[model samples]
Structure formats: C-alpha cells, structure tokens
Target: MAFTGIPFAALDFYEDLEADNSKVWWNAHKDVYDRSVKAPMAALAAVLEPEFGQAKLFRPYRDVRFSKDKTPYKAHQGAFVARGPSLGYYVQIDPAGLFVAGGFYGATTEGIARFREAVDTEVRGTELEGIVAAMQEAGFDIGGDQLKTKPRGYEADHPRIDLLRHKTLTVSRHFGSPPWLETPDAAVQVRDAWRNMAPLVEWAEQVLQ
Candidate 1:
C-alpha cells in the first residue's frame, strides 16, 4: 500500500487508551485501533522499507508479567528497522505526535566496551564528536543510557568522557502534532530524519555491532 498519513483519530485513540487501558475498552474499540492506528503505521513502514530496510511494527500488547505498572496496552504505536545487531531506525505515532530516531540501543556489554575504546581513540573519537555536534546543530536530541561514574580506565576529565559513559546511544526528534503529520508529507518528514541519522547509525554499526 502507498504511504499516506496518520489520521488525527489515531492520536485520539491513544489518548483515550491512556485513560482506560483495560480489556473492556480495547474490545469495544478494536476496530478503531486496527483502522486508525495499525493500518496507517503499517503503510508508513511499507514505504520506508525500500531505503531503510524492512520495518517492524511493535505489538500493542504490553508484557505485564514482570512489570509493576501492568498496563495492558502500549500507549504508543512504534515501528523499528534493525540495521544491525543493536542499531536501528525508529518511528512512532503517539498522543503527542510523531517521533523519529535511530542509533544503537542496548548494545551488548562487549560492544559497549568497544564503543568506549573507540571514543578513547582520538582519531575515531573526534569523528563521533563531529557527528553528534552536527546532529545537535540540526536540532536532534542526542540521548542514551549512561553510567553514573567513570568507565574504569577513562580519566574523569577525558575529552569525550560524556560519550564514553554511554551504555546505549540514540539520536531522536519529535514533531509534535504538526500539520504535516496529518498528511502524506508525514512520510517525507520521517524519511528526512532517518537519513539525517544515518551517519550515527553507521558509525555504531561499525564500532558496536
């Protein structure tokens, strides 16, 4: 199917789900979920696969067995394209709006060690610094999990200590309820963000994956 746009009703569905995350609510409105939320998301992912590779739409059901919150359904609908072991591109439609992101998420311990080593090396480290700097300059928010303290061998004042402490890395941006999100231009916006993130994703794939 050709990519179109996320309907405004999709966002409304998620907002209502937040208030009533029970089987009764889901059963009553499943057609709306299928039509407004899942179909549009699948269409969007289908169009993105040519350049970014196949995308996986996350299932809405939440795994509550190990969690305390126990919400039955996810509050958002997200899609991911796994470019490498722990590296990927992602998009989502939520109550707030569309979110686009890409990078390494939950890379293995050994991979994180290699990431730190690469950051500790001046030649390679400066390349990453430049990538992050440019993304920030372009208004993307750089984020990831980090250690509270140093990564053992690195000095407290290392040039890229901040980058060195990352256990997982990602770059993301949110386009909050923009007019484009409710039209076919939504695909263009998502494509642009993913392309912008290619450098960072490629770097992590080489170093961490």
Candidate 2:
C-alpha cells in the first residue's frame, strides 16, 4: 500500500496504551495496534526508503532489564532510515505529536573523539558552526547531552566550546497535531524536516567516519 498518512487512531492508541500498559490490555488490543499504528508506520517507512535508504522500524517492547520503570511496551512507534552504519533520519509518532530528527544521537567513544577533533579544527569547525546556525534559522532544535564542565582536553573558552562539550549531536523538530498530520502531507512534513537537517547529518557522518 502507498503511504497515506498516520490516522488519528494511531495517536489514540498511544494515549490509551499510556493509561493501560499491561500484558492483558496489549494482547487484547494487539490487532488495533497492528492495524492502526504499525501498519501506517511501516507504509511510511516504505515510502521513505527510496530516498533515505533502508528503513527499520523499532520494536515497541522496551528493554526494561536495566531500568527502573518497567513498562512492557513503548507508548510510541519510531523508525529510522539507514544511510550507513552510524546515522540517519528518524521519525516518531506518539500521543504528544510527531518528531523528525537526524544525526548521531549515541556516538561511540571514538566517534565522540573524532567529532570533537573536527570541531576543534579551524576549517571544519567554522563549517560546523554555519551548519548549526542554518538549522536553527530553519527552526529545528539542536539536541544531545552535554558535559556541565569543559571536556578534559578542551579549554574553557574554546571557540566551539558548546559543540565541543556535546556527548552526542542531533537535530530535531516537533510538530503538534496539525491538520496536515491527518492527511498524506504528514509524510511530506517529515521528509521536508529531514531534508532541512541534512547538512548536519552529512557533517556528522563525515566527522564520525
């Protein structure tokens, strides 16, 4: 099936699941989930695969073995386009809204070191600054965890201090339940958002490579 858009029922499923997150409830409503939520997401992924590369849907089951809150199922459905081994575009649909993001969200130790090195170099560092500025100007949110203090080798007043302190770097944008979300245009919105953030994704890929 061609990708139309996410129906309102998908959001409704998440809202309902948030309240009743139990094995029994989930098993009973599994068909609703498969039809209302997963199918649309799968179709959307299919539509995106041509331009973005192979698409993979995330499992809804949470890995709670290491966590405190042991919710059996995730309240949202997410998927990503795989451009290479490290980073690609991401999409999520949940009760709250839709989110589109890209870049390296969980960089390896080597990846982080490489990224910082790129940021510290004059030419690449200036290029990165401009990319980030363009993303912000386009209204996407810069994301990732950061160190409270300066990283070990970097000076406190480093020119790229803000980018230097980041453990992971990603660009994201959120959309509330807009009218277009209920139509085929939702996929268009996500595609445009990802396109808008492509420079950052490309930069991160090069830095991490």
Candidate 2: tens digits of C-alpha lDDT, residues 1-209: 77788888888899999999999999999999999789988988887777777788999999999999998999999998865555889999999878889988787888889989999999999999999999999898998989999999999999899999998888898897787887789888988888887888888887787
Screening candidate 1 with a backbone cut-off below 3 angstroms (N, C-alpha, C), the clashing residue pairs are none
Any runs in candidate 2 off by more than 4 Å, and if so which?
A: 84-86
Q: Please report the candidate that would top TM-score against the real structure.
A: 1
Quote the lDDT for 113 in model 1: 89
Cα lDDT tens digits for candidate 1, 104-205: 888777998899999999988999999999999999999999999888988999989999889998999999898878789999999999999999999898
lDDT of model 1, residue 166:
92
In model 1, which runs have C-alpha deviations exceeding 4 angstroms? none
- Looking at candidate 2, the ten consecutive residues that score lowest on lDDT are 80-89
